[model samples]
Target: MAVFGTNETKVMLPRNIADGMIKETRTLSTIAKLSAREPQRFGETEYITFNDFPKAEFVEEGAQKASTTGGFGSVKSKPHKAQVTMRFNEEVQWASEDYQLSILSQLGDAGQVALARALDLGAYHRINPLTGSVITGWDNYVTATTKSVEIATADADADLRAAVGLLLNQPTSWGVNGVAIDPKFAWSLSNLQTKNADGSPSGVQRYPNLGFGTDITSILGINAAQGNTVSGTPEAADTKVRAIVGDFQNGIRWGIQRELPVELIRFGDPDGQGDLKRNNQIALRLEVVYGWYVFADRFSKIVDAV
Candidate 1:
């Protein structure tokens, strides 16, 4: 008799074409949106860098009498060696194909989101770092001369205004033209009220248009934006950077490489037993070179408001 029967039942395997898809998650790139991008050139293994020179001092003319040897200011570019990476698994791509979705597009989107978030955080650290801590971009050139203002527990509105006032006091005529506030703090600020002569609520609103849905786009005639990355510990006595106000154009610097480098290898696996080969997946990587600099410390202010 033959080993195999003439009639046999075969097992039926389900195809991946019927799987449902879930909604995408939210990723905010707040600081990146506010920053300016300048391109720089560097080798793949080398760090990116840039320089910022402070303006030379001005002296009163002495009736055409030559001024003593006024020295020139020299500032060197700060090196940015920090890099962030992103990876996508092959299994996820297969599942995406089964679900009738473009895995490559999804991966690209996720990669951009990750890079944006990482860059935003990098900018924040350079701009509003904790007390006694050395800042990245500014520490290299200037001594990271960050200024701050204290806030009252019950009323932060006055403190906020005062903070803005302090920023405007800088010698630069531009003054403080921008501010980045914590989302939670901004929410509380939206409800701030003016006080009566007796320090009681005057039934009048201050910053009536400060909230999320208001028409008032700025606070104190300066551009204002809400960023969750603005760091601050609610219960700790340590210095928390809740808000940052400044002439961002002259205070903050963002540098981009020649291009946003993205690479994908559909058949990176040569053998059929390696991780990629066995998993039947492709490979993807993102590489970017950039640098950041804080030009004038006095041009910026960080608020430690709780």
Candidate 2:
């Protein structure tokens, strides 16, 4: 005899659904791989922590040893709760196996898309926030007064060079040096011209080999990417940050306190008359507990205008 009951189904569903949802979420979210990610243990509480020490310097063999002060440092990120819920009509509970399978697949796909966008937007805001209103001053914003760079002007190459130079000039080594630019600026870059020493047209194209299809993969020997979310409005003249260049892996820290989990509640709908008749719809909740931190301001440089 086969053993199957409500108790067994509930236990199995959460485990299987959580696994499938995590896989789907990763596939749909570019931010997962674009930045650094740290997984938290189950039921762990409090904030995630990161520590870094200074590099050792040479000292005389018999001389007093040099103390690497300020080398020992730490930062923390408090995990925030994020959730999505999908409700299925009571009829789905009794529907055919094929019908049930179809609905579940659709729900999973939609949920993943929603979660991915949320994460991408969160990273965007931190990497490029409003000029004077930066949330935590974590964004490495650049301006004419600060770094002498313009975002929406004809001289885009100069701005890019400035941002890239900042990252390269940092004292630390970078694991992944790349840049994320607004699509509009990227389009502007594609039209850049190479001028002659005499101020005449050199007939040489700056970004002659740049491609805008799907995504801008590379530029000027560095990994280049384009996304409109990097700024609020690419056309706005405000202090909108237009582009960023640096070691994203060492800059952005993403933390997860709990893996995504799917839970179902049959008695969640008290408004429906079916609740009293034991035929109410099922309430599906998808949850993810995560947080993010931008460490080392020098790891990222932003191009903006004031």
Candidate 3:
């Protein structure tokens, strides 16, 4: 007997498509490129954080060694699902093999981009890209850290330097090795100019290497990535977060689950639009789980004056 209902069931995406999506996500997401990552499963994954490191002490001969302890803590990375669904013409199903592959590739591209954006939005701003709302219960870097630098309209260089200074001056001495900056903030840096002896703008660019583009790889000798997600759209008109500077190797960690499911639905309205069957459209839904944790006092955010 032919099982027609089974044909509409969801299935795991091909390994090639899934791997390509992950590669594109890492390429597009600034945080993903800078932060430490690990393989995450469906459940919680825990990583240890050191509050203090025990030091070796010089002991006198015949003297008893005193007991020493180091402060250690753990942070659990809880799985958060991010999904993207798109509708396409049903005619794609009857297309040639090459044409079908092209359509699938395009769908994969959209899914990767959405996943990248969601990572930035959730990790940096705690915003959910799907609902355009703040995700409760999880504190993003902006809300979780107290260290911050306010940008002055007159001195963009000072703003960046101040942000780095905050990290270096911390009691634990955080390093400023990587920076994820917003597009608007990058523009500010590129337009910065030195002043002449008479207080006039010296035509020379203060940071000549810092340009306003998506391909920015470095800023002032520090690794950098530019994306609008750095300063995500908040629900309210609050202080705009411009950049995050920190020890990317140790300050934050994130990961995505390997299994990615892509489903094809030819009936019903999955997106609240008209029915797909009635409209002669089919929907492709891609889902993947992601997790992240930001260490306390390890990062400093730069924001415009409130």
Best by lDDT: 3
For residue 262, what is the lDDT in candidate 1? 33
Give TM-scores for every candidate, taking all chains together and pairing residue i with residue i. Answer: 0.62, 0.68, 0.89
Query: Which tens-of-lDDT digit does each residue in 107-152 have in candidate 2?
Result: 6677766665455455555322223233464342222113324565
lDDT of 1 by residue, 97-183 (tens): 334134434444565544554444455554322132434434432213456665556566666777667666655445666666766
Candidate lDDT scores, in order, read: 0.49, 0.56, 0.78
Question: Considering TM-score, which of the candidate structures 1 and 2 is the better prediction for this target?
Answer: 2
TM-score of 2: 0.68
Candidate 3 segments whose C-alpha is farther than 4 A from its true place: 1-8, 60-63, 140-143, 212-214, 233-239
Q: What lDDT is reached at residue 258 by model 2? A: 71
lDDT of 3 by residue, 225-244 (tens): 88888778543233388888
* Order of quality (lDDT): 3, 2, 1
TM-score-better candidate, 1 vs 3: 3
Q: How accurate is candidate 3 locally (lDDT)?
A: 0.78
| Cα deviation of 282, candidate 3, in Å | 1.8
